[model samples]
Target chain A: MQRAKVVGTLWLSSAIEDIRGFKILILKDLSSSKGGYFLAVDTVQAGVGDEVFTVSGSAARQSEATKNSVSDTAIVAIIDRVNEENI
Target chain B: MQRAKVVGTLWLSSAIEDIRGFKILILKDLSSSKGGYFLAVDTVQAGVGDEVFTVSGSAARQSEATKNSVSDTAIVAIIDRVNEENI
Candidate 1:
């Protein structure tokens, strides 16, 4: 799992059958200090400015929205707050 | 696979054995044009600000650097250019 910040949303008018009816979002990768981002399918109702926890691979499939769904990445949790004092 | 732009690099002092000695980067997810990003292991010699093709899951493990290495996401190709006239 990794910590990420939601940057934007993805609207797919026509998508692969397996990915139909899913809300996709663009997330900024925060696991590393370097600023980066990626497209992820959001299971949780994350908004444009929310911080989230992302799970990839088989673990991503275990999410409530991806259960039995063909997805490689999913937002597993919505972070309430971040305490990065150690860093 | 997804089309992404390399945004930055990640340095890990302490990492899981499976991911040791690998160059990790933060990638902006451009496949959906949502301006999102994710932390990914770079298999190709992709520099920051380069557009890349990313492969996730078991497929990522098939890359030259990841062959027999335990990783879930890897930069599979360095995109020469993007023609998004369709978008």
Candidate 2:
């Protein structure tokens, strides 16, 4: 998983029928050399500015919002803190 | 970066005006203990079965296709293999 910040939210009027109850958020991927971001499905009730953990693909499909959704990204956890040990 | 599998592709007819020329693909996150997947932008020309490196957020927005896009995910590289060192 990667550390990310919730940057924004997406409002979809018409999406797949199965994903009607799910919420989607735009996330910034913080694991890259230059850092990056992307839109991801939110499952942990994260808000803008909160750091989060994201899982993608079949794992995303495992969430109720994506039970039948065509989603590829999902927030699996809200990060309280991270510890980086020297390599 | 996390290892992921390209599971599928997304064909959008109308998206943010800035994202018109970008291609979107669905991805599976391979890092979780249970393993998961999600949708990610493709920058490395990866195929459905290819394992790739993905960068999200502002980093995703850094690509030419997403120059003005409202995208949250972007594939950064293609992986030929991975070696798991014992922890």
What are the Cα lDDT values of the candidates?
A: 0.70, 0.64
Best by DockQ: 1
Q: Who wins the TM-score comparison?
A: 1
Tell me model 1's lDDT, rounded to 2 decimals.
Answer: 0.70
DockQ of 2: 0.03
* DockQ of each model vs. true complex: 0.07, 0.03
Candidate 2 per-residue lDDT over residues B13-87, each given as its tens digit: 322233345556666678766565555667677878788888765566676765444456778889877899999
User: What's the TM-score of every candidate structure?
Assistant: 0.52, 0.48
Over the stretch B1-87, how does candidate 1's per-residue lDDT look in tens digits?
Answer: 476788898888777788889999999887653577798887667889987766588646654467667777777556543322111
Give a tens-digit lDDT track for model 1, residues A50-73: 889998776767756666444567
The residue-by-residue lDDT of candidate 2 on A1-87, one tens digit each, is 355789999898867676676788988876544466688877667799987656554445554445477777777555544433221
Error of model 2, residue A29, in angstroms: 19
Candidate 1: segments with Cα more than 4 A from true spot: A85-87, B4-55, B58-87
For each candidate in turn, give its C-alpha RMSD to the true structure in angstroms. 10.4, 14.8
Docking class of 2: incorrect
